[model samples]
Every structure is written in C-alpha cells, then in structure tokens.
Target: MSEGVSIFAVGDPAGAQLNAAIRRTLFVLGEERSEVWNGVLQAANALRWRRMTQPQPRQFQTQQPLIDDIVRQAKRLRNLVSDGALLDLIAEAAVAVGETDSPAGAVLLQSIEEVGTDGCVVVASKAAARAGLASWLDEIGATVLVPSELDTVASTAETSYVVAPPSFMPSSVVTAPMTPEVTFVMPAWFGNRSLPSSAFGGHAEGQIVIKSTVHTIGDTTEPETAVAEGKEVADVYFPQPVWGTRSSGEREPTSDEVEACKVLLAGGLGLWLDDGDRIRSLDPKQPEGARVGYEAVKGIVPGTYLVLRQGETERGAMYDRAVIALGARARGILATQARWKARLDERLQLIGSRRAMTELERLGVRSSGQVRAWADPRLICPQRDADFALLLDWIGEPSHPTYGNAITLRRAVYKASADLRKELESAVGRADLRALERDGILHLDLPREGFRGMIVARVLAKAPFTEIVSRHHVRVPFTDGSAQWLD
Candidate 1:
C-alpha cells in the first residue's frame, strides 16, 4: 500500500532450454571428468546455451559436418511427400520461386501461397499421373497439381519439369536426365533455384556444389552459378511470441475511508457477542419482538457513523465471505445430490493425452483433478544420474508408482520433453520476441492509479499496436520467414 500500485509484466519462463543444455553437457563429460573440469565445463555449457538462445547463421566456404548425411536423408524422404517434408519444401519454394506465368507453375505456387509458406505444404506430381503418389498426397493432406490442363509441358519435353529441393527427391530422380522430359530439377540442397534444362539430355547433370545438392537439365559447365547471386540464403530463425497478462495493484485508501473501515470492522456492523454467546446490537432501539433490530432504529443517524457496503468495507466483506463460503458449500452439496460428480469426472477425463488418461485409470486416477496432482513438471522430467535408466524404468512401470500418476505418465512426459528440447535447439528470432513482449504490454488493462502516464505514452509511440488499441484486438505472427499470422 505504501509503495502504491506497481505494474509489472512477465512471460512464460525461459530456463527449460538452458537446463536441457546443462544436462547434455553433463552427460557429455563423464562424472569423474565433469568433477575435475567442472569450471571449464560450466563456462562451455553457458556459452553453448547462449549460442542456442541467440542463434545466427554461419557462412561456411565448404560442406559442414554431416552435410552429406542430411542430403541423403532429404533425398530419401523427398518423394515420400507425406513424410512431413513438404512443408519445408513449400517454405523454400515460396521464398525462392519469384514469378511464373505457366498455369501448372502458378497452381503449384498458389498451393503454398494459400496456406502461407509458414505452414505445411501439400503437393502432387505434375509429370506422370501416378495414382499411388496422388493417394499418398491425399492421405497426407497435400494437394497434387497436374500439368496436363495447363498445356505448359514443353513439346520436346514429354514429362513436365518441376523444380523442387534436391533433398526431397530420390538419387535416381536426381540423376535421371529425362523420361522424354526431365520430370523435376531439384536444388542439390533442400531449396528452390533457377536451373537450366534440355529435352534430349544435351547438357543435364546433377551436382553437389559447395554445401548444396543441385539437379540440372541443361548445363554442367558452371553448376555453382545455381546459387543465388546477390542475397545469401540464411538458416537463422526467430523466436515464438510470448504474450502474458499483466495487472496492477489496488489504490491506497484515503484517511476518511481508513477511519470508516476501522469503525465498521469493530465487532462487525455493531453486533457484538456477549458472555452467554448472545448477539447484541449497538444502535440502542431494539424492539420488543425483534431479535436484532431490523426496523426499530430507522431515522436518527446524522453523519455520526459509517455506511458499509459488502464490496467496499471490512465489516461487510466479512458477511460477503460467509455468504460465498455458504454458497460454495450449497453448490457442492447440490452437485452431489443431483449426481453430477460422475459427469464432471467424465469431463476431466477428456483433458491431456489419451494414453496418459488410460494409464492414469489403470493406476486408479480417472479425473482431471486427480491427474494434475500427479503431473508435477519436475517429476515429468526426472534428474539424470547413473540410476537414470532405473529411474526411467520405475517411471515407465505402473506397479511402482512413486508419484500418484507416475506409473501411467511417461509418453506425455517424453513428448513434452521432446518439444522442450526442440524449442531449445531451434533459433528464436529477436523480432518475434520483441513483438510478443510489446503486444503483451499493449494487451494489459492497467488500473488508472498504476498506469504511470509516461509508460503508456511511451509504449503507444513505439509500437504499431496503437492502431488497434480501440479494437482491443491483436494477431501474433509466426516466427518463420514466411508471412503468416499465428493467431
């Protein structure tokens, strides 16, 4: 109260990534080595965590480690469009494929555009009418574009040439010159690039240049020219938006209100308990038949006392608290009487993972409320040690439930662990983080007493959020390079 109302904002915690990195570092250094080189290891671990939190792209002159392995995987998984690689391809295409007039090309580009390249992309082969590929695309929620309707297939080229990332095509597809026409030309790496093509295999060759894999149809003379001329392609990504609510504290009371509260709080509304436990009123006009003077003391007060409302004063707040408690008890009793407990339990059962729910039931926990008691975030992510396997085994087994829900809850925990790991490993962009922080501040509805004029005006002047202040609406954008509105 003395400090007045202070307004501060915060977001979701950020230690998960750092924590995971520390664990990894500890694992990498054996216990004996870790203890001996603890100081050096700790510094290195911190540096690694910082690097992960604030990621940047490296301009390597040659292929980095495992670049070949990555290319191999991409090639294996490319044509298997349903294997969660289409989205990445679509993203690359949107950023790389500038403008094309061909209908089939337009359609292919439009598919990525409609979803906005930030999300997953669905694609079908335009060269040959492959039912298997079409069905697979459909199963995986991607749209297949056919080239026949476009008449864009070249006269000399029997197969329509579509450009995709090299990583997404098979080695055979990458090396194949033309089945009458080159079916597709892929950037040796997982990307989209302008590639030369010929119908009769005059000068077509697939080459891995520098760090990327490229498939070409026409010239093998300067394969390196396939790389973008002016602008460098970067792999750096931004952080996700982190918005949170902020509330200000209450205002300080005036001297008059303080005095009033004191009077009202005295034995509560002029009713005091006697030695015999009898309730007595202080108004001094008790009627003959009235237990407490309801109508006897009506008209004599003239600014000599206080007026208390349940919402505004201590004495009235006491009664309010009693009423709320009674109401809660009554509601609980009514719910039990009406046999609604089972329905409520059924409702709780629908939250969280299905497998977790099943496991909880096996361990005699069937309700949402019960699940929370056992779902401690710490236990979900146990500490690492030589007994790590034993601990994990114990956690995986239902018979030895350390925590109430421990036996039934490893997959959900594991999935959460994996997600946190991925988030930690990924690069978070500064722009996205700034936008989210600014938006969260704008979203706040500060109490008049706590707003502190300078702060509000400063925020409004800085961000683009002021335009929509009247609407009280906001949209958080995705951190992906593609233009996308997350929510």
Candidate 2:
C-alpha cells in the first residue's frame, strides 16, 4: 500500500521463479486459491519489494537478505496451512532458486545442510495449526499429518510429535499403538488449562520433548545466578501448586485448604502477600520500594515460607446487614458483661462477710428485688439519676451535684454510642469477619505466595486443572529460574 511496495514484480527472474515455485506447490497441495496461498503471496511480495529508504553506514549494515525473510515467513505460514510438507517444499525451492549470493544465505544453506532431512510425522490440533506449528515442523522437514490420517499412518511412522492445546488429552489423540511425545501450545492470558503427567500415558513415564528454537510470545532468557528471580509469564501457563498455610507458624497446608484456595482463585478474589514483609505487593503498577520478595509460582522451591490471605466464600444477600447487627450486639454485650460479672462477684464476697446488706441499705436501701434486677445480665437499661448516684457511691467515686443535667447526660451518651458504633462498623465492613473467624483470616509460612491483587493473578494463582477456554503457547518459568516458551 505504500510507495515502492507492489505485487510480485514481473521482470525479476529470481522473484518470478520463487512465485512459480509457490504456485506449483500450492496447486499440488490443492491450496492454490486458499487463504494460505494468498497469505504466502502477500508475504513474499511484501518482502521481495521491501525497499530501504536510506542506505545505512557500512558499520551499521547487517547481512539480512530477502531469502532470510522468505524462510521466516515460510516458517510462520506452517500455522496457516494444513499441508506443511508441501509448504516446506515450496520454501526450500524458493531458497534454492532465489538470490543467494549474500553471506547470510550461505550460512543459512550450511545450517540446512547440517540439519539433514530426518523423516518424522507431526499430528497437530486445529488450534496448533492456527498458531503456525505445522509450518515450523514442516520447515524442519517433518511430515505433518491431520488427526484423522494419523490412525492410518502412525504404525509405520518413526518418532511422532503430538501438538495440541494445553487442555487437550494427549492419550485421546494418539489412541494407536505408537510412542508419541506431547507438547502443549497455549496463548497469552489464557486460563483453566493444566498439563498433568497422566495425560502423557498412564503409569508409564512419557518423555517431554522440548524444542529450544521455537519461541512464543512473553518468553524471556534464563538467568545465570543462584538467587531467585521472577519472570512473569501468562497466568495460565505457570505450573506450580498454590502455596498456603493455616497459621502464621511454618506448616504444610491440607488438601482441603488447597482446594479452597483454588476455588478462591477461580472466583478471581484473594489477597497475595510478599514472603519477607507479609505485605500486599502483587500489584505490578506499584512502585518498587522493596527488594524482590515475591517468587513466581513456577519458581517456588520447597521449604520457602510465604504468607497469604484466606479465600472468602460467596455470601448471601443479607450478609452485610447480618454482620452489622452481629458486630453491634457483640460490642454492647461484651462491654458490660465483664463489669457486671465483677460487680456480682464482689457483692457475693461482701454478703459472705455480712456487709453487703448494710452497704446496700446505705446506698438508698435497695431491697432483694432491686439486687436481683441489677444482677441480671440480660437487663439492659439507660442510666438514670438514681442509678448513676448509686453506682458512684458504691464504687467510692465522688458524686457531682450537676451529674444528672439532662442535656449533658444526653450529649455524653450520644457521643459515646456514636463512637463505638463507628468503630465496630469500620472493622466489620473491611473484611468478612465471620468467614475470617471460621476459616482463618490468612495463611502464612508457606513456600510461595501469589497476589490476587489484579485480575490476571486471580485467574492464574489457583486456577483449577480444567479445560482451557482457548489455545496458545506461553513462556513457562521453572523452579531453577530458567524459562522457555512451551509451544
């Protein structure tokens, strides 16, 4: 669409030859008019006519030629087409007949020679095909097979690769009697996918074949130190147990607690605390004032201690009002319960000494009925002038003549009541107090901690081992701090 960019030029012999090869290969594969063929033509045309606006200085220039771009695009095309063998043949033909005088082309040719054609079959899912995996295998000279055709050809094929989305069952795909290696390709920000060893084969150990050259999105290089490092990967791709504990002391978490954590994570809510400080630092947007205190789930080694906030259950519609009333009643009952009990105990002690009745008579001659009423824990009443005077005299506090002023007493009680109510409401509103009391507020002293501070963390931290919503590849971090894109 830009200046100097056009369809494949007609006059250039090398470009013409490359275009002819592509056309012939597509035709042989019955894909000449397919989207794959169109995409290839557009990619090749774009690269072949890509012109540099200005010549770089001699020192800055690197030996990147049109052939290299052709190969790169060819590899990417594997995901677009179903027939990788033909696509690879087309790419090889293009490289062989196209311009190759550049030093980079010479090196590429030599590398291709070293990686001699070794015949292997690749069975890829539709999702993997869209991710360009088939093309990549084809570029490496592997015969890519559709799932249906695998049953017919698998017995005779040597070394089969089964590539599928993380949620797929590898055993189900390769039902025929042949040893197959599996690779899970997952995309960015995907959730609810897990890779269990059981999927490979029951009881028998299956080899995990990892390709070092294939890189996916959000991948980073491995660190070269012994110290722990955090490499953020897509939440769904992180393969590690959710670390948690029941108490602040160091202890292992029970299976039920772990499952609860998984539920909380699935619901996309929970608190994540850093290991050292026990502070909420899961937010990436927050400024880095502390040293690296959080380790990714995949990088957590056994014996490391971590802190975590407990997960909350789904509350009923009346939860808020019920908690408020509970908190208010608790405050009122607790405030007087201890004082009332102490007063009763003291009265009993005095009665044993035959001084309680004398003291009661001195304080306005209280009868047995009055004593019984005052001692009742369930009797909640407003402070009256007589009661206030009696309490002051009984407690040996000097009574003031103006103590019963109506406005003063009203204002004092109103302020005290308001303050107490506010304090209780704030405490109850911040967290589910009932849940916290029933199922401890936080889990501490575990090996690893995850912050449910953001949506991504919640989806990943304790996601269940269930079917994936979508398919793609992601960079996975290991316990040793090394990482690679598992595609």
lDDT by candidate, in order shown: 0.26, 0.33
Per-prediction RMSD in angstroms?
A: 29.0, 26.5
- Model 2: per-residue lDDT, tens digit, 70-118? 5776798788777776566546645643433222222222333443334
Model 1 per-residue lDDT tens digits across residues 187-235: 1222233333234345546633212223232222322213333434322
Regions of model 2 farther than 4 Å from truth = 1-118, 125-131, 135-141, 146-149, 154-156, 162-169, 172-234, 238-487
| Residue 297 in candidate 2, Cα distance off native in Å | 39
Q: List the residue pairs that clash in candidate 2.
A: 78-135, 79-132, 185-472, 186-472, 186-473, 187-472, 187-473, 272-451, 306-446
Which stretches of model 1 miss by more than 4 angstroms? 1-163, 168-182, 186-363, 366-487
